[model samples]
Target: STTAMAGSGLFRLPAALNPMDWLAQPDKPGISPEPSYQRPQGGIEARAFGNVVHLLVESMANAIARGEEPDVTQWHPRAHALLRAEGIAPGDLPHQTQQVVRALENMLMDPEGRWLLAPHTAAASESALEDETGRHVRTDRTFFASDAPLASGEGTLWIVDFKSSENSGSDVAAFLAAQKKLYAPKMLEYAQTKRAQLGAETPIILALYFPLLPALVYWQAE
Candidate 1:
């Protein structure tokens, strides 16, 4: 199988993406930033905002994997620093800090969010894996969960990518459907690369986690 070739490091997905361009903006047509939580200073660039969120989540994931509890209360100062580093003006730091911190807290407090981020064997954040074509595939998060299997006997390998978009449309179903359509290809690629590394028989699950909307959208990969 191609996956087996990839596992041997002989086959990999082509290297087409730059590390800096890994994030995708959710502000596509018909989708907009959540109005209620919009930044007071207009708003930061979508990519910049996403970078900050991804960094924080990465930090939290590593901490969890290391058996350290994340202290949400202490996140404000960290958020301020991250936003400032992202070129956010100092004056808008307070509002943006709160926004980012609150989102993190919500993820920890929410059941689905916590489960997606929960510690598992070999859990890693911003994991960079090589495919058969010498392409580097960077995944937002990947973990092994023996307890959560997609089938009766198979252990589950999870690939979760984070999105910073918030859903504002009245039709929640349609909004999520659009998001899945927009991102499934990339997620599928991540799954394929992983399936090769882990073997074809292992069940791999692909997920897009939206911290802003506090939602988990996942499906099993064939």
Candidate 2:
């Protein structure tokens, strides 16, 4: 199996492949590698905005795990302080903080969101996975059923990747279609790696959580 080969280091795979890389069609005989395009780095304001939202969500999840309602007001100050400490401009903090607060509020109100964020015995944030050959992948959040069986189709694992695009637009259907095209292979890779580490039969669900949009998109491994 590809997963087994990856874990055993018997197969030489690319060290890392982003979603776009996985989406590329290089199998055609006439195909040539696309010219490298260096995307511009997100401005400090944008970077800080995402960082602040992520921090708020992390804190909220932690609070939920501890049986407490997350205080957005408290987190707002903390996020602002963090941005200041990191040299992020203060001008963007207010709007970004409000965005984070609204996202959290929506998540708390949505039943599916609440379920996904529910406290679990086995949960990890910013989890890292690496094979013996140093090939690696990272996930934003993961939850495993505590008593799930390792055998095929008897247990479930949930892996989430967060996206922070403010420009995803109002067309949910179109956005989802594009997202599936871009992220399907990457999510499958993450699931395959987890199966290799866990067991072949354990079912995995990969999710893309857009906190700013307050949306949850998911795919299940076959």
Candidate 3:
């Protein structure tokens, strides 16, 4: 269930749950016509798993733009703060831990503005999202196209579901369970909020990225 987490002005989402079917069999890898499910690239869908790479990059950008150090748990805040001149105390974390985090942060921010990666931005940029964008609705309920809340350029939302049985131990059951527990509630929350934001229902777009079967299971509320 999409529990309403109240806190900051923005909704506080529970820890994200990756469906078992989200990743394909690490052992039985193959290609499929699925859009978001299968790795657009390759390699057992490792990079494409939840494809949070784009988010990680964009977050780095936002952190840079803000000038606030994103090193929440830097191993060595003392040295880091000294370098940035933040004059902050080094937390209890180990020096090596801090170094690793700082390195990752540096790597992400190194290119800086050169990298503009986000679902919407990348999709529009490559023009692949158009071909990739799809609509999917909950199997338990049905909503009309007009009943949708806010929508993307394709006039809908996307749930890029990935399914991996090889990694998850059980394939079909795991994938389906993920769709219901992890993806479905999240999609509903997105639909509800988009509608609230735009003051109207926007078509819901759900894309299930299944790497095991190499298929993108799509659903829409229309």
Q: Which candidate is the best by lDDT?
A: 1
Predicted candidate 1 versus true structure: per-residue lDDT over 1-222, tens digit per residue: 000101111122224422223222223333333321222222465655677777888778767767888977778888888788778877877877877887798788776677667765556677666677767556777765532322222145678877777778776567677888898898888878766655666566677777766767777675
Judged by lDDT against the true structure, how good is candidate 1?
Answer: 0.64
Error of 3 at 15 (Å): 36
Tens digits of per-residue lDDT, candidate 2, 1-222, equal 000101111111223422233222233333223221112237766666666666666677878899998775676677668667656656866776677667677777776666656765366555566543456455667775322212122134677766666545667767755766687797888888766666566656677766656666765665
Q: Which candidate gets the maximum TM-score versus the true structure? A: 1
How close to the true structure is residue 216 of candidate 1, measured as C-alpha lDDT? Answer: 71
- lDDT ranking from best candidate downward: 1, 2, 3
lDDT of 2 at 48: 63
Error of 2 at 191 (Å): 1.1
lDDT score of residue 163 within candidate 1:
76
Q: Local error of candidate 3 at 195, Å?
A: 1.4
lDDT tens digits, residue span 67-87, model 3 = 655544532443343323322
For model 3, what is the alpha-carbon lDDT of residue 69?
Answer: 53
Tell me how many clashing residue pairs each candidate has. Answer: 4, 1, 32
